[model samples]
Target chain A: MFTGLSAFPLTPIDEKGIDKRAFVGLVTRLADAGVDSIGALGSTGGYAYLSREQRAWAARTAVEAAGTTPVIVGIGALRTRDVLNLAADAQSAGAAAVLLAPMTYQPLTDDEVFGLYEAVTAEISVPLVVYDNPGTTHVTFSDELHGRIAVLPKIGSIKIPGIAVEEAPGRIAVLRAVIPAHVTIGVSGDWLAAGGLLGGADAWYSVLAGLFPETVLAITRAAQTGSSAAAVAASDRLEPLWALFQRYGSLRVVSAAAESLGLVNSPNLPLPLLGLDHAARRELEAALVVLGLN
Target chain B: MFTGLSAFPLTPIDEKGIDKRAFVGLVTRLADAGVDSIGALGSTGGYAYLSREQRAWAARTAVEAAGTTPVIVGIGALRTRDVLNLAADAQSAGAAAVLLAPMTYQPLTDDEVFGLYEAVTAEISVPLVVYDNPGTTHVTFSDELHGRIAVLPKIGSIKIPGIAVEEAPGRIAVLRAVIPAHVTIGVSGDWLAAGGLLGGADAWYSVLAGLFPETVLAITRAAQTGSSAAAVAASDRLEPLWALFQRYGSLRVVSAAAESLGLVNSPNLPLPLLGLDHAARRELEAALVVLGLN
Candidate 1:
């Protein structure tokens, strides 16, 4: 099930808490778009910024709104205990799988990271995706570590960060050689999604697909069908938006795009992470207009 | 009040939550040693792995145990709202000041980081200490950014990570030039505490001080009194222990030492953060005995 496009939607949270209405709309929209799966509460979902109650509600809500589309709920938290609790909540809420990242405050050791996966995988009933997002979690998984953890029960997928285009095949090959055959590889970082998918990644765990499902799905379908040129061309068409994502981070830039597109209320992000400034917002809007996304 | 030896004790916790008796004992020991201040809930205190309620209880317990000793509670959380709430709880619990690190899961921007300080400073009743431990927090503050935050009201201190012995003076000088005069600088990284203090830092935020206050206070005093050789000699005496800290992080090593000393129960750390392995613990015990710290 961890194949093709896994759209990661923003939770649309603010000072009051999860923007349930906007969130349901985002999820329902993804379900309608026929993406392979919905990854609610991933990095783009801002799981780290939310409370467990809020996150559980998000998991249930995303599952409900996604209809028949499989919803993979991200249950990453600073504590192993909280992650277990969240996994139970996600499973109870009828999630297809639970995405777990080794989130840290006091930088975790390799053994500690392994212990996290070991402890969680032991209790969780659902298939667990290993979220190797170093950009946010700061816990990088060496392939040796990945190999060790992959043999654990219920380990379904491995979500790797985007590798440079030229390095994607070799990186994916190295990772693939370690994990079990059934454990699919999902690539994140929307700008590099096309190359990663073409380079033999089984799925694209995407930020852009959350808001612009059809847009990224075009690239995904093209890549999956072996039309690499079309996939690259489709991705190239949104170069301007990707540039903005690169400059200001996909979360902030996507929030700006969502706000500008009037899909959600202004200041949609959680605090300390304000929406982009006026100049950056203008740049984002200009990019959207250039890409005909607006 | 922010100057001198600031001891950050481990918040002896396991699955059952904060060991109130052991925690109070640690706090009382620091107070009895006449350390300059008690930094409750700092990284060594495992504030990140704890719930806000647990942290509030820790703040109150530490304050009660410390008697007249001022307690600075760490109030870092992933969200600004949570950070604000933690700060309020800390202040209500009678914390002398709130220590905050830009604890990120989604890497924050310069503007967002500055905005975090701006929003937090405006709300907290207690003075705020900027915790700059990139080793734990993963958020590195620029001198320009430090200068920007220092100008804000209620900014009391900056806790910098340790530097190389030779580079300490130049590094401190560069940092001192950027921030305001009144905001004191406290140096962390126990092994480098002597160098940092001798380099003209106002305080030593020593992890060792949390467990063995007298051991570190001797070094701090010698450095503060301009006895450079004495301070270096005192630090040098603990070279074996420092080497262990360098090999396996200070937190794990210190926890092992604390448990070995019968100060806390074994496996005192939060889940996912296992105690040092048998070999590492043996190494730590050997080092402690060598330094006569056991």
Candidate 2:
């Protein structure tokens, strides 16, 4: 199930809470575009800023709206009990798999993190994807720790942060040799998806793909078919957008992009996290058009 | 209101929910021992690991148990709406002040952090303490950011993380110069409390003082009375315990210490945060005894 382009859509928020209408439309669009999987509620989905009930509804909605496309729901929370409840919610909602980042409040020890995975993996029925997004979750997983969690039963994939394009091959090889063959490696960081894909990552767990599925699918397909030049060209074409993602973070950049594209309501992000400012928003809108992503 | 030793006790939890009886006993002990204030749901209280209802209950219980002693309730949450709800709950519960750490899932910018304080400070009736806890919150506040937020209406204090004892004098002096005279500067990090107090800090925001009130009170009282030598000596006596705190985090070390001292039920911490292992427990018990903190 962990292959090709997996689109992680924004779980848009309005005054009421999860704007399910906007969320469903985003998921349905990804499925209709023929992306490999729908990753609902990754960091892009603002999973941490939600309540258990809200997260459960979003998980169920993503699975229902994705139709034939598999849905991988992000079920990360600060507490193990909460993560277990979320995992149960996602699995019962008919999610194809579950994504878990070792979300932290107090800094975690390697042992605590491993214990968290062990406890959850022991209870859940579906395959689990180990989400390693240090920028958001603030928990760094060492290669040895990754190797340990990767072998646990139901571990379907490991979504790793991007390495430099030049270092992707050797780095992925080093990681690939340590973990089990059955566990696929999905690369995140929209800007680094090409290097990760060409460097032999099995899937692209993407943020922009949620809004612009066709654009990323082109890169994924070219990489899958061994058209390195085509993949690089496609990725290079979106450099301007990637620059904005690097500058404002893909979540904020895409929240603005989605609003500008009329895919979601403005002020869509959960509060305490504002949307991009006027200049960044204008720049993003122009980039979307100049890159022909509109 | 934010001065002297503010004892931050654990809001102990059990199978059903908050162990209110245990929590009340801890708060009562702090109040009875003549602590200057009670910090209800600080990081040591596991504020990040609770629901709005649970936090509200904890806040009410602490204020009620603290009697006339001022109680500062921690009102940090990942969402601004939740923080506002928590701040309102704490205020209604008769809390004297609120502590807010800029909690994050997506790492926040300085502007966003400032915006959070601005938004919350506008609404809360009680004074607010800016909790600059990077270890748990993973969001660092620059001195410039602290200076900006300290001027916001209702800002009573800023609780800065500890620096080296040698650096404390100049560090506190620098910060003291920036913030308004009414806004007290409190220093956290149990090991550095002495240096902080002697270094011209207005208060010691302490974890150890929660469980061992008399122990840290001696140091606080010594510092308050201008007995720098006595304060240093008192802090020195607990050097072994501080060694454990530095080795394991103060929260974990204190959780283990609390359990050993029969302050609460075993496994007092929130889920996913296990208490110290057997060896650490054994070491902790020995340290408590040898240090005469038993």
iRMSD, all candidates: 0.8, 1.1
Global lDDT for candidate 1?
0.91
Flag regions of model 2 displaced more than 4 Å.
none
lDDT, candidate 2, A9-117, per-residue tens: 9999965687778988999999999999999989999999988899989998998999989999999999888898899999999999999999999888898999899
Worst 10 residues of 2 chain A by lDDT: A14-23
Tens-place lDDT digits, model 1, residues B191-259 = 888999888899988888999999999988899899999999999999988998888888988899999
Model 2 residue A4 lDDT score: 88
DockQ, computed on Cα atoms, for candidate 2: 0.81
- Cα error, residue B34 of model 2, in Å, equals 0.8
* lDDT scores of the candidates, listed in order: 0.91, 0.91
CA-RMSD of model 1: 1.0
Q: Write the per-residue lDDT of candidate 2 for residues B144-249, one digit (tens) a residue.
A: 9989999999999999999789999999889988889999999999898899999899999999998999999999999999999999999998988898899888
